[model samples]
Target: MKPVSLLLAVALGTATVVSAGPAVIECWFVEDAGGGRLSKKPSALLLRQSSESPPPRPDLDPERYLKVHDPAGTLLAAFRRYPRDAPAPRCEMSHYVPLPASAIWVSGLTPEQSCPRALDGRWLMVSMSSPVLSLSSLLRPQSEPQPEPALITVATAVLTVLTHTPTPRIRIGQDALLDLSFAYTPPTPKAATSLAPGPPPFGLEWRRQHLGKGHLMLAATPGLSGPMPAAREGAVAFAGWDDDEPLGPWTGNGTFWLPAVQPFQEGTYLATVHLPYLQGQTTLELAVQKPPKVTLTPAPLIWAAPGEAPPELLCLVSHFYPSEGLEVEWELWGGPEGRFQKAEGQRWLSALSHHSDGSVSLSAHLQPPPVTTGQHGARYACRVHHPSLPALGRSAEVTLQVAGLSGPSLEDGVGLFLSAFLLLGLINMLGWAAAYLATSEDSVEKVRHSTFLYFSLLILSPLPNSSPEGGCWLGGQNPDLEFTQTCIKSCHLKHAT
Candidate 1:
């Protein structure tokens, strides 16, 4: 038969193979397999009125061979031939025959021999009745069924997306499940497939041709990409601690009571968490989470004075939360160990004060002097007692000073006059020193001492609470011994000086 085509139109607008009749058909020539899905090929026939003649036929070239199973399942046709009445058998060989459009059927053309010779295309021309029909029939169209995406859809895409599943951040060491949903579907049910990259990868073999480009194609719309391009990175770090030592992974338990991480100690951890990557790059950041804040207050400072006496100056020193497995008991301290004492005739001090909540405090007074110290000084403080709180230990200390009395001469006589002269002279000296030093660049300026300083100096040093210098104490006396003699003379005179 000639290699020419007839009125073959693609009813579905697909680029169909050339056919021989006026029917616009999308066709496939399937080899009869014993069982399983029938696979088809791309070539089609363009039959003509001139092709009704009989001719020699050709044999199939499979490793194992059998004729196409008959449509009726009765007698299978081993091979096909062309009409001899048509143009001469092509290249001395043939795979199919053509019949006039008017013919209703064609015969199997049984041979005279039981074991007939195997057919080769070179022998003769043959004829057949065409099976192809017009395009307006039941054949499906070849157009894509998915949404007609704009070309700008590709350019404006900010992120790689899938129509079926949630947008997932690609991460290493993670398992990703993607749904196959983007496809051009027909009203009738059908299946399609795609193959991604390779380790041993998915390849394109359904159409019997290897892909020759950067990416392979599939029969679906809005395609998805394979793994991201970056190398897989796995890492981990310390989040924080609970008390003093670093905490473990369970640190974030109970809505994260403690910190989830530490100060970032060095170590490696593998987590299967989702993370975003730069486009076309496969990299996700694996960093530590900030640990929660776990703080604890130190135990309270509720203590009292020494001895069995409870301290008086006690208050709740403070409060704090206890760490795990530890319980706190607020207490009061009193008695001899706390320096508690009973006043000579007053009611006994409460051993400890109790709050309704079970917390306690001491109730003891530490007057100026102990019973042995004779109440002679003002080194006094209040103490507290608590059943569970600490014992007083010590009191806030005070310094005592015994003031020396002045003499009669200091009150109205020569000693007073002399002391006055000494103070005036000292003032004159300070003024002179200020005048002199104010103009000196290399020296620090002198500040005048207050009169109180002079008085304190006279009392503490000049007389030293015992000596009579500066006339603090007096007799009818000499300035040197005035302060000492003053009190003595006053007593003899019936009123203190």
Candidate 2:
């Protein structure tokens, strides 16, 4: 018979057709002949069934035909029957369509049922049910003659990953459960149009590489040896599709769960999926950050002289990984009630020091504004920010202590010097007037003694009190004039002697 358009509509509950428009019904019997080689042979046949045909026997011998399973693990038997004298149908090799095998394994349809209008009223129905076959069945040795190697189609596939964590990047101490969906796109648009609407078939493999450690396989079970003992806890558990437990509207999707992320899990993680004829991979980089330890140096109580700039505020951030996101913010709390404000005239100089242990230390130096006695007790805070820190960040603060000037002020020293000079000149003029009025030697000596007493009193009166009793005659209510009185009394006694 001429090659007929075999619309292989196996009876699924929904009665879906596999192909249409003059397509040959060819079956590929694949068997693994050992040594990583797959033997695939094609057999073509024409199947015809009438509405009056008897119900299919439930006990068809499974060994008479090649058994295959759909993506749902449903058993399907492919066999051919013809008269003993008839020539075998010619099998023409067509490009692999990449369609889902499940669409070809429909059930629950009878010949009496009308084919879909898209099929143009030409179709065939078959009923062959048996126990679901494992994929290993395809590798078993067949009693029939071995066929040629199967055509390996190299199609591009898209790998999509959805992480369950709140952040796109995984943090340490979090369990990383990834839902991986692998879909294969046919090489040509024509083949893509023939595919069923569902996820493609594939297997997953995980690999990781740490900074110092070499590449290691991350198995889905425990007790495997790798770079880090913590990574061995990772395992890949297959999430099979469940019609009862619907995951949104997607069907035939597969999920793989990675291990709980540990503190030591750092480096690049690669997830590769192996489709029947295609492979794809994606990578996730985990730097395994260490939270920065912020410290502000120079003590909490900083002492600075009035009208002088305060000491540099040193904000040291240590033991942090990946030095890119380090930030230091300086704030001043000095206004009424100590309101918050950014420190003015803050010139921050930063330097990053890399350690041998893959951690970085940042020293941020900020020179605060000049402070006066009025600004004493002002607080300067250094807030550090890093990727590992919380929103508020880490902070260290210091209170300003504006100290008084160490020595006498210029104005005070000048006033004291001028006062002493005028007092000495007046004493000289008085002594000269007294000596000129009394020409006697005793009178001159008395004037000279009075002059010496007056100068002595002036010199001693201005000195601060350092006596054990903490008392001084110059501390009287009228100290400026009381010293003159004391000096006069001493001078009179000296002159009488």
Candidate 3:
């Protein structure tokens, strides 16, 4: 006999143990030749051997064996026969248990072969209807040994997360794209593959969406780009995977997107994303805004109607939200040429326009100069414009009055008073002439007196300067001629008296 065993099963040589634990199916059985030629006949015959050991057979298939099922729950399969050279059996199918030390086969030939097995479990010896392992008669472990399907190649149940790290927070008006992935082990997953129970990177719309949604819109292509819209009210909902209706006990998580906007304002904002399979969420931040603008109007003291007198002007002012700096100034045009005049009792020539509504405002008055008297239809007005740039402000106008009063002439008073002076001088001249005529006893005395008065009288009106020889004189010489004539006339009058 020789050491015979299955093709891949373990084998034993001469002097191996007589009793051993359940053996792997052996293809070759070692048996004594008994001086007979080999027999090769394929026949259907079933046999069971309740022996302590398996008899060796060279005719069996390597590593192939049959199982025997009993009405009870016991299971049995073939094992390698020991002794390196055990006697072979001639039957096709035989059930056996090796016990009683080396005693295995207990056909009716040897009741001494019946025995018990090692490992303490009872096995029935019977011919099987089907192959147990390669065939379908036997059932393997059913329920998973752990939560997920895992191989026991390694001793420990180590699980490395073989998916993308959780997603990050997304911002408003921003088309930032993110790729989710991971490297794990039992061995790391291959590239671009995801777990069957959860989403691939592109599952949730809130994390990503259709082209231009109410908020955080999608791109023309798969990722964010191409005319995307900003998020509204800054909100969004996150969930892993599609088609997760009512999300059963399967797997994953739900997340929320807090508000996010672009062109950030000067404040704080928040955001969230859901990992359905992981049963959790992620967060992010953002800020948003725009700038401010401003404007003006004018009112001057006086504004003339198209034809009426110019009315004084009035004014007002205001500003816009987030107002910047204020620029202000004024100008006067298309009006009477007059110096600016203040009212008798006012400090500021202009009044400020008042808006209780909190606006910027201001105004002034122009005192028109006197217009020509009796001059009709004099046209005059003043236009005070503000830096109301881009447009001309309202104007203040003034109308000149032409009607006036008439008074006494210059000569009326001057002529009356001048004539009175001439009359008084003439009366004095006559009085002196008459007194001379009345008092004169001698001609010489009367002439002297008359000449003096006549010369004095002539001096009343402007006359040429007098001299003695060829020109006139102040003394009683030629001056005596008029004086003598006057005396003779006056003397005759006195004689008549």
Candidate 4:
């Protein structure tokens, strides 16, 4: 008899001719017989069905095909018979001894016959409903094989293989995408051309809707351009197929795309996909951009009360991105000219921060100039430089004013006292002049001494540059012709007397 091609069951009593030429089903069992060495006994089997026309006969007798082999080149079973047109009979086998062997059935078989055989135990059973084949096995007590339906119906059970490697961290405000590549292998025979390594067209949305859940949120397109497919819920946009179309299990290189990841949504995410023969999962720890916030403040001098030591000013940088790149500076403005520097105080210091939250701060003591009078208020400032911020950087400034006892300062007070004394002397001299005008001309000589003395005091309002003793010289040089000569002559005569 020639090798036969078995037609898989499409429905209860229907047959399916593979799109490819024909179909074949195979089953095998193996065992290790002993010591480090094992039994070279026969274990594998093969079944094939024929599509050629049958010869004229009383009853239709389909040709049969079967082959069996082992490492020792042994044949366990070989036979030929006509395929049963009606529903294949149902048979059951159980309580068989466990052994180091394996049984595999492949080709266009129904779901009932496509189940995986137990890999570890003892007992073995097989139920053959079609002229094709069936098989089973056993292992240790660790795990038990679940019971499958006794009928060999349609093909089911596919394997899913997902491939994903860790990608670079995603930056904030930038577009990001998560693509999960996938493939599926149907439970068909290895020889079936349709059983290639590829994913089916199952709606990615369907998979997500059923198995998808987490804190991860999906956003609409971020307007990014690249060779990667546009992200969609049901399937990969670049898959070259519609979202809802169902593809064969063999063409398994399908990719499912998640929604775009937002900048604020940063965390580890777990993604899992379940397919017929296999299931796969991967963990993605997402990174995001967080700009730093800068603050300028003064540390407590001593709680609510002032301490012996002056207060320290601080420049605090918080919530920064790329934590390693944080930088801070302190400056003082207001002195001889409008300039600033970091050396005005006792110390220009920055405290190191080891926090994972990406926040850092700088601190230093505040020191005001010693000559605080008459000078304008001193200015304190802080500057923060970070890549996340502008090139000019961010900064803050403050002006501190120190007031003296005599108004704003002591210099103003001395000038005011001098102006008042000058006014009083001028009034006295004018009174004396008026009194002398009422008296006789000859009497003027007697009061001349008093008049000159008052006039001299008023002229002395502006201090002499050379010496305090030169004050009298200033009095004699007055621009009034009457007083310039009279006052000078009287002082000379009085000193002579």
TM-score of every model?
A: 0.15, 0.37, 0.17, 0.27
lDDT of 1 by residue, 420-456 (tens): 8998888656544433443334522221222323333
* TM-score, candidate number 4: 0.27
What is the lDDT for 270 in model 1?
14
Which ten contiguous residues of candidate 1 have the minimum total lDDT? 248-257
Candidate 4 achieves a global lDDT of: 0.37
Taking the tens digit of each residue's C-alpha lDDT, what string does model 4 give over 1-497? 11131112122112322122212333222335567654322121122223542122222111111121111110111112224353332333222342211212111122233434522233232222232322111111212212222111111113222223223355444544554443333333442222433333232211222123443222111121223223343333333222211233232223334344344344554443333222333444456555666666652111111122224555566655655565666666764445765635554555555444443444433443343433345566767777667787887666544433224347678888899889888776664553444343566665565455545544554334333343235434446766555644544344334
- C-alpha local distance difference test of each model: 0.22, 0.45, 0.29, 0.37
Clashing residue pairs found in predicted model 2: 10-106, 11-106, 11-107, 11-108, 12-106, 12-107, 220-235, 220-236
Error of 1 at 34 (Å): 37
Error of 2 at 3 (Å): 39
TM-score of candidate 1 versus the correct structure, residues matched by position = 0.15
Mark the regions of model 3 whose C-alpha exceeds 4 Å error after superposition.
1-356, 373-388, 391-497
lDDT string, candidate 2, 1-497, tens digits? 11131122234411322221111234444456799997655533222222432223223222222222122212112112222343332232212221111211111111124322322211111121112100111111133422323211111112222221112345545556544433232222332211444333234455667866755444221112223223345555563333321111112233434555554566656655443323344445555566888888787678888778888878788877667787788888883345788887656555778776567787878887678776777788889888888899899888888786345559889999999999888866765554343333455466556555545544644434435533233445555545654544544344435
For model 2, the stretches where C-alpha displacement exceeds 4 angstroms are 1-161, 166-202, 207-216, 219-270, 278-287, 336-338, 345-350, 355-357, 404-497
Give the lDDT of residue 82 in candidate 3.
23
Candidate 2 lDDT score at position 17: 21
